[model samples]
Target: MFSAAAALLAGAAAQPAGAEEETGSGHAVVRPVSGVSPLPADCGEPPIDGYVLNPNAEVLPTVATDPNRPWHLVTVYQQDRWNRYGSNGAVTAVSDDYGKTWRQSDNLPPFSRCNGGTAANGGDYEVTTDNWVTITPSGAAIAASLSLSRTGETTAILVSRSGDGGRTWDAPATLARDDNAQFFNDRPVVTADPYHPGVVYAVWDRVDATDAGWTQPVYLAKSTDDGRTWTTSKVYDFPDNSGVIGTQLVPLADGTLLIGMHHETDTTAATQVIRSTDGGATWSQPTLNVPAPFAVGVRIPDPDNSGDPIRNASLPLLAARPGTGVVSAVWQSQAADGTFHIDYAQSKDAGLTWSSPVRIDKTPVGSAAVPVVAASPNGTVAVTYYDFRNNTADPATLPTDVWAVTCKSNCTQPASWREQHIEGPFDARKVPLTSAGRLVGDYSGLVSVGRSAFTAVYGVATGDSANPVDIHSAIFTG
Candidate 1:
């Protein structure tokens, strides 16, 4: 069920007792499950009514949780069965028992007209991608996604908010709409203000602003009334029509906000951080912390990678340390051996500077991609990723398994972290192909539920035709 590369990774490593590996920090335990748990069937199915089904994939899932009410969690993603460019529609899942159980609902807030009709039915492009969700201190849960018209001609950013603990959402709000059909919006992120309950910020990359080429112009939208009204404008513009991606937002404790993204210009790639003092109204020049370009994509040797393209490539994720301005960022990096692994760095002074990057994944062979990091209230840093290391058969077809690492504190040192096996070995081959390639997802979701426990949501193959790709939730209590 795996591609050629994944089977090879599993074959390279031996499955020690319980798949546990002893690291410098602690014992890394690979907990076994009876295959992946099923997500709500109603929520996992896409509404691909009229369009011809391509390699319909349920990918790019993200999650948000209530800090005050750890039991309340929400996740949103795309159900793209028709085409890779457009999803059937955006789907939402809600969990009230701290991710133990989930329910699917398309009761999204009402949407505005984009090109022809409502944003959902805008054009032939008919897909939604890169959706994100956040819960404010006031219990208002908000979500954002990028909508493209038929044939992927035009793009727009849409938003929905819920005031009743994510049970019911208000009308959808249009944060940013492309004036020119040639322009595109990618990977919009939503973040709630840490200091203010009603304040929220949404940021995304807009391409082709000045010239015909795609330029990376970061746009910001602020909602002061908990998603009632909005002000949208460009916050930072890169020199030339240079390219950038991976938009990340984090609201600091002192009323300021920090945005992180990967900036690519010419032949070089680097990590960039820009800050705003007065909300999202203005920003400073991006500070280049890491000099190396984010790895393009990993090669999973055995499977015919020709058709399977990684959904979201070379995107950086950020997590703020508890009780301090220090923040840690993780992204996929190609090692000297030509294998992809997770890399980490931290900025102690509120995104001003970063430490040297260090590799986190312990797999000696194969590739690891799509990493997400989260910091607990007690300063425990947890990182989750999927790798092919567990598929040990000689001509391995077993799929990728989810792995995690945790550090009590001072996680910057690679030796201080302990790796743990979460779940996997499902048939990655069962996941259908998209225009972007075989899609497990662009990214997975991880959130700190309590002081020591963490809840994660990720996509895995169910080996069934009804739903080729399914999203499952797991909890890590170490």
Candidate 2:
């Protein structure tokens, strides 16, 4: 017999068709994808950070679409958050008819007990974090995550493949694992090569601790046979006490690869990039792209929280125009007055040189977090993020909204951009409160659907503890 949670999850496979809510300017249409069902209470692990499980919350979503079949869309997210670190397990939702409806899949390779994990299957971890999904040119869907024990006993990177458009999944293949106390892996990203048929790359940071301090080095694992197997290598390492995190891989149309990361020292943090010409064989030394004014991995505090804050970061999002070699990056940076703003920079010559960073968020007040960027075939760039500009003087409630900005050409100039309100003005304080803070997610999803329209999959709060957060999608035209 299936558990009550499992039975409910099975019944939630086919979500109802969402009603179209067009923006006032008719530039975008928003749809509800995941519906209002509460997530399953699947993980039996005890909470470590004094916070109870928030089973109604769903956070940290990543999305992708099959190029050969534009109607095939896949989104992976963390469900039933603990308000501290990870989730009960990750959930995969597939939409074959564009964004109209979705089918939630239960085959995610069991990263925890919630997903039928066991020590025999190498999924004995207590919780999972950082869910990412991508579709290859041949319609194969790949999902990746950071699976680890809550007590810091083990940490690993795992990838799973789906051959039938995400209706089901095969057992996940472990890409890298660390059993000792000295190494911890975090912030993994998986990308299928757009030009190469069966090649996919996963990049992350493995942090090592010594008597001096902590040092994190970038690691790369390449799978040439569509994630069946992987060959791992250490691509870059910093000196002791210095490291990097949030590594992102962007494969150009001409077969060149660019990896962008947040390089950090004890007192400084900067956005940096590295290039690989002959695939993953060798890489150039890192080049400093933008020196950040604030720390990279620090979580933002909730304005309404008197005790615990919300868990959010300012990780950089990178994108490259198909054939023009024009690469753009967007991230949240804190100003001198302690306000966070979304910033954008461009690189015309691949990942070598970058233009000066410009403020992209049009909000004159409040802070922004979790910026995501995507590029269309015609070189148009779009960036999406959430801001607190709608919040009033009420400390009991925090009103938040999602906004998107797009630019066609001359993107370096501040005036060349157009801003549109995608969704929200919801109560941000209604999310799960964790040791890290109240949680929406560390990142959201935004991808180009065609030449001008982009689809974003993101989370929002509903002010109801019984159903706190829900995943929504917005398709907007530049």
Candidate 3:
């Protein structure tokens, strides 16, 4: 029954305009522009002047562009350098000139026990992180994030909407709130319903402090009146409290939603999902793939610090074609020689079945991590990721680059893709580390604009006197 539902939804989504054949011959070209960060010099945070915003880190940028106005783009992200449980707030950036430049805004929504902020807008609760933004066909923008109160005793899922192209926003409405004294809420994502304008969806996993220990339950919510109000449902209950990360929600043209997430246990990691056909009202049983050998480790150049690795591991990334049910997924895996590389697979029949996994990145010398994939209106599939391939310096200092590949046509064919450089050659060490000790946040973003274009935003260490990690945007065309 689930397979039938997936196939039906896949068929409902419109396929790309042309045949599934190669179109261009050259490489996937990305033009760089002078984009701006969402936060100002002081990030609107009064007390801290040049001290924080000047050399601070803005990471995990998620973008949403207007369908009619291709040049109008809206993005949201977390503020402050990596502070683990304590983050400044959420900030927004708007671009009207095809991403040539950006304007900052304090449009983040608020949550329980806290009145929304303005003088220094951003952040939900007193400490917030894991922000996501998306746009409706009417060009309205919606933002969501996980936030905690000043005392960190409560956590809530907060959302806000921007009708004026992100220049201004409405007060946030809360979807879920809990004491959070023993549980934690993290990594929540939002998606706009393409078929039904003004309707949007949000999903995240909830950890509960059960008497046995802990258990993870997935939750879903929907807002039909453009985020003014919301209704939430408990989607599924995992057998154990395994950690779920890198969750991607894909809304089909037929009103069905597909969720792709990486579920991790103590010994192994796997890609899993729970589908909702009636706007997240109910969900099918969780479908999981075979477990892959996985371990978290960071490579350091200093021999003395080599054994002490940071929290790092491969998490699944997913993308779905605009009109078609064709979906592509990628993650990182280590080969026999101990080299980490990016792997790819696709599902022609929605999430029912996927092709055999194929290694996609060029010969891996250093390592490739945090892969993000997106599909163009022309049926072109693009994958963006960070790698140390160009790092000639000591591995401890970690110099990396942002690279992308285009599958002109037959994306399922491993050899049908061409590689192109987007941005980078910056020192990763300069970027602040999360409580997890990982740089560049857990994931970045890559979004397709129109028939022939796409955009990606990532964090890069400027290595200037301040040594801050700033946000950079690149527009790519074949």
Candidate 4:
């Protein structure tokens, strides 16, 4: 179920409990997940759906810091089956050089199966989506969670932890132990407080029935000790369908927590959430922060086509920190010329508010979809957009590149976005300062060598398929 590198990483280190390989600012001592030197046959599965979400895939890479070894970068990924029949779990990789090489976690479930079920043709139903990863200061542990596929009608809140680097992990535990699950959950995100490395917070969509398979309302939960246990979750009841949704966590240098999400109905949606002085223990009412556009589309499976005219998708919270919680987010909208444009936004307040929505590109035009973001130590925010700016003319043409934009203090350069397709096969992006002012995007997300370079991991594309995405990384200087 793992690639050669992942199996090797697990075998390479028989670390003592609480041991960690050092680097900088709590990053994993990562080796590239798949190297250009020639992929090992056992590296891992190939890309799927012409997209990153494989039946058993790892996406949404995140870095966490360790207090004692503040140099190790431990990254975590949300793993499900390569097709759609696989269940939920996490796949982990670590970096020693700052976001480069990757090794899959051994002992740990390659996939976090909060709910067990047989995989039919690698397709499983009712599993987790959008997992958030974080690390503890002592370099003693790692934590994260997702919307677990519990029993009937229950999109349960699930959390998991790892001790001694990323080699092995503990079983996933639930966030809300009580019996008040009124709504279904989507996207579970976590952020460890800078001041209190032991403190962690998670925010997610708490809906009446996201069973419709879209987005809905939101709620939050907090943990005072790593991710061992969680407090009861509280739904942030909003005023109608136009409520708070798309929950993400951003912790400040002083332990303050900022939660960002989208606040709008079908016609008035915008990117926004809230901030908590006492962690997720309490939160203010929904705050109307950043402006982002959310569009709806449909996909009908076809046996004779290379593409769907309307492929619907949305981005969850990327990465966050203080003064720069939101770097980028994506949604679809129509340009003045009546073409669909993928719009993005960055937030500085950990989602308390956000910059205006910037249109990256429009349809010929088709549009961009599933955008994500990361914060750079140098104060730059890196954004990754899966672009299809030329798809209107050729349905067989897959997105040629995953592009990036580096911005500081809410960059709103609409005209600057005109220069598109600066990168490749990447689905994710992150800014690692030790590597320099580089902007990294991914077919996958990983970087290990350039302490001063931004790195990305992505999967290689061999042909056009519905699952055309996988994990790979590259480094760049912003």
What is each predicted model's overall lDDT from 0 to 1? 0.67, 0.77, 0.65, 0.47
TM-scores for all candidates: the values are 0.83, 0.91, 0.83, 0.68
lDDT of 2 by residue, 35-141 (tens): 54333443457655564877757788888887665545789888777755588788888765455456677566576667667778767777888888888877778
lDDT of 4 by residue, 1-478 (tens): 2443343334453322122223334232223452121212233334444323233334445555443332345665544332232225445566543444455555542223332322421112244445456666645445544443333244556666776656676666666422345555555666666567667677776656343433365666667776677775565665555565556776766455666665666577555556677655567764545454443322212112453332333434545433334434444455454344456665555555666676755323444544555555555555555554433333443434555554544455665542333344332112111111111211124221222234544433323233332455544433
Clash count, one per candidate: 19, 4, 5, 95
Worst 10 residues of 1 by lDDT: 15-24
lDDT of 2 at 366: 64
Q: Model 3, poorest ten-residue lDDT window?
A: 14-23
Query: Which segments of candidate 4 are over 4 A away from where they belong?
Result: 1-71, 78-89, 109-126, 140-152, 177-182, 209-217, 240-242, 264-268, 285-310, 316-355, 360-365, 389-394, 408-410, 414-452, 458-460, 464-469
> Between prediction 1 and prediction 4, which has the larger TM-score?
1
How many backbone collisions does model 1 have? 19
Candidate 3 at residue 400, lDDT? 75
After TM-score superposition, what is the CA distance of residue 248 in candidate 1 from its true location, in Å? 1.2
